[model samples]
Target: MEIEIATIGGYEEVGRQMTAVRAGDDIVVFDMGLNLSKVLIHDDVRTEQMHSLDLIDMGAIPDDRVMSDLQGDVKAIVPTHGHLDHIGAISKLAHRYDAPIVAAPFTIELVKDEIQDENKFNTENDLVTMEAGETMPIGDSGELDLEFVNVTHSIIDAINPVLHTPEGAVVYGLDKRMDHTPVIGDPIDMDRFREIGREGEGVLCYIEDCTNANKKGRTPSESVARDRLKDVMYSLEDYDGGIVATTFSSHIARVKSLVEFARDIGRKPILLGRSMEKYSGAASRMDGVDFPDVEMYGRRQGIERTFQRIMNEGKGNFLPVVTGHQGEPRAMLTRMGRAETPYELDEGDKVIFSATVIPEPTNEGQRYQSENLLGMQGARIYDDVHVSGHLSREGHYQMLQALQPQNVIPAHQNMKGFSGYVELAGNQGYKLGRDLHVTTNGNVIQLVEE
Candidate 1:
């Protein structure tokens, strides 16, 4: 049996993740994502007119040209989660190949919403939904089996897929952490991973996330963040001003915690911004989680009216949950900081950022500007009351020990993060470029029979 793997994108960078695995005559693609930095830089003026090829040229999306020769052999497109970096490009690129798009329900809903927003939904591209813990056969001859192993992450319905091929099992272990005490969904399926490692043909290759490899010890659980948020909110119970909290819109568990705490403190929880509405609606539709008591405003005019009402009712009576945790220039929190909203920031008002700045230059600049604007209005700023969703060094070590694959490939990182992963893997007795593969995008590694 011949099996080859190619890194289409997200090798030396942190976004636009796409990987192609070819087993004999059939090929299965994992994740058609986008590089947000590139998209922000290049697609600012003519975003509407930018085609798939244009995005590829600007590095906004994956350059599938690497798979031109094997396009006809492609069987399926699988996405692991609903993050924009993981599912944003599917609407633009899925039409290129004659295959169905498969993912968990929440992810599929997010993809569908993207297609509708872009007006690019084609009848030819079908969507197939697979719940976590279910296994399905792909390809015309059913030569490959795809299993979705449930895992906990920032988003609900996240999974680590294991592709059972004729040669062996190939595991895609990216964008997830081992969170046993998740706030909303089930914990990581440790038993299933161990079974795959010890049973059957065993894991031949493991492609893992190295985003947080520089950090030592296991990444803290979402429950930890929940506790931190509770402490922050409870401490402000006596403060007589509006409380504004912001985080990633797709972080449903975080949203749930915030909403619950807001309601518990007798404050009305209001969700603002288009993304906040889209992701929360998708989560509710998938039966993942629901915030029936929280009022959400998606349109600009509606959000304006909502803010006006909050102002009239007194800021201390309501909690505003908004976007712009990364300080996107157009997001609601930035607009609020700029005093564009009808509601004014009062002295000693709290603006809590339940997120960390993603260490990118653009994000750093934007976040600084936003914070400056809020600080000028006498709003007290609290930041980084959250935990990351990716695995740290100890988390990676535990995963390696559980899976115990023959070869390890560090993915979803730049050189710094990958180097950290290399050092950690070395401690486990795996050498670089031999049993461990550290490669850049577009590089192919052919696995030989042992």
Candidate 2:
């Protein structure tokens, strides 16, 4: 049996992520995501209509490197979560493999929404939905076995992948934080992780998410954000003008918190922007998390109506949850900057950003422009009033010690983060590139019986 791993994208950099894992003759791909920086800022691949294939052909990201050698042997395409950086490239890239795509239910729902938004139907590939604790048998190859182990991340339905092989079991603990107090899902399945680590013979390698591999301390729970948001909303309630709160659309738990907060302070929750509607619709439709019979104006007209309502009913009567935490120009906040909405920012008005900067040049500039515009309108702006979803270095070390896998690999990191993983692996006495593999995008590493 042979094993290989490659970081097709999101290796040298942080987005347009694609990763391939091969065990013997069977192949699996995790996270065919778009490089948000490239698509939004650099290449300007605006709109959902932009096909990943077109981007691939244009050399936007390395496509062939991820697709090669898996024409018919592809068994599954799995995403760790619903984040666009993890699943955005799947419908566009994975459809060609003719394999079943598996993910947690919420992730699948979000991907479906994304596909429909782009007006492209991807019914060619089989879609299998599995919850956090379940294992589904995949592939005709005799030596391959796969399982999805639920874990905590920014968005819900995050999983750590396990591939069982004759040589041993390989765990992809990709893009996770050990948030026992995750707002939306069950706590980390530590018992299962320990059992898998103990039972697997070779357990040749463990590839983990290194998004926050360099940071120290455990990531705070989503509940912290909820409490802080509650306080901010209450404080803003003192103002009579429009109060707007923006966050990542996929942050269902955060949205839920906002809904509850609005209810607490006697304000209705009004969702704005196409993304807010899409994700909220998915959560209600699939996950059974319904927001109160709050008024929802869907899309273009919906946002305009929201602005009008704020003008008439007073912004203090409602909480407007919107997109554009990253200051993407087309998002609700940016459009507000352009004065497309009827409701204008006024003195004592509140604009709450419940997210952090993604650290891209365009994002920084857009955020600066948006903040300035809001400030000019005499709005009180709140920034970085949020916690991260990724596990920090100490969190990574804790999980590593908890699972105690035989080998360690760091994934979902750029070169600097990967170097940090190498240092940790060295401290653990794991040899780099052997037991501790630092894989690049599109490159594959195999596990062989020792």
Candidate 3:
């Protein structure tokens, strides 16, 4: 059997992540995602109504035209998680593929919502739900199989999909940290990973996320963030002013902590904003999720009414957990900053941001503008009460020791971001352009020629 890897999108930058692996006559696509920063850079751009080619030309979504060069049938389109960077382009480009979109339950539900909400393309790929620690056959070849290994990240129900081929296993490792004690889901399966490294022909190719490659030390666990959040909220128990909390809507674990701690501080917690409703609503309905039932409003009228009620009842009595941690223009917190909403920020009111600014110029500018607007209104900002979801240098060192793959690919980052990881891999004795591939989009690397 022959083996080949296509370095599609997400090779040069961190956002649009798409990779295809060909083992013999079967090909499996991993993460047909969108470069969300590309989309956000253009104001008033409604991507749901846009065409695939236009979005590709805008550098918003993956340019999968390179898929035509591969000589294999796509067996499955695997999205590792529900984050927009991983699954955002499913509705845009999935209609072009004949493969089924296979993912975990939460990711599948998110994909279904995206497809249903799409305005232009009618994407009708078969939705297959596979849980973590499960395996399914891929294509007619009995030698090929697909497995989902549980992994811990900011989002719930995240997994790393592994393609088992005749040569060896291809581990699609992205968007995870070495979290052994996540608040909501199971721990990162290091035992299974170590087992896989020693099993069969060993790992043939190990593709990894290098988002925090330049950062030193280990990425702290979600449990660590949870403790820090609890301490912060508990210390604010005596203050009687308005307290507004914000985080990633997709980060269900952090939201859960906010809700529980708000109640602990004797305040009613209300989940506001569109994405807060969408993500928390879907997550609470899923089985095995430890999310609590809380009041949420997504629609404009409903959110307005809720804010009015919060103001009427007294700001000290309610804790509003809204969106806009990164200060997206249309998000609830940004609207509040601009005073476009009814919720008023007083002189001593608190705004707790449980997220850090994404290391992009567009996000930094928007966040700065939003914070300035809030500061002008005399809102006391409590920022960066969060931890990253990607591995740092020590975590990368640990992964290489565990997997010990024959070939490695650094992904989910730009060339500058890949530099730290490149030096790290070199220290581990992997050479560039030989086994450790530093590649770009729309390129192909042949591992085993027929």
User: Which tens-of-lDDT digit does each residue in 374-432 have in candidate 3?
Assistant: 99988999889999999999999998999999999999988999999999999999999
Per-residue error at 93 for model 1, in Å?
0.6
lDDT to native, each model: 0.87, 0.75, 0.91
Assess candidate 2 and give its lDDT: 0.75
Better of 1 and 3 by TM-score: 3
- lDDT for 359 in candidate 2 is 54
Estimate candidate 1's alpha-carbon lDDT, on a 0 to 1 scale.
0.87
Candidate with best TM-score = 3
For candidate 3, the 10 contiguous residues with the lowest summed lDDT are: 284-293
Compared to the true structure, candidate 2 yields what TM-score? 0.93
Model 1 clashing-pair count: 0
User: Which candidate number maximizes lDDT?
Assistant: 3
The TM-scores of all predictions, comma-separated, are: 0.97, 0.93, 0.98
**lDDT: worst 10-residue window of model 1:** 40-49
Q: On a 0 to 100 scale, what is the lDDT of residue 441 in model 3?
A: 93
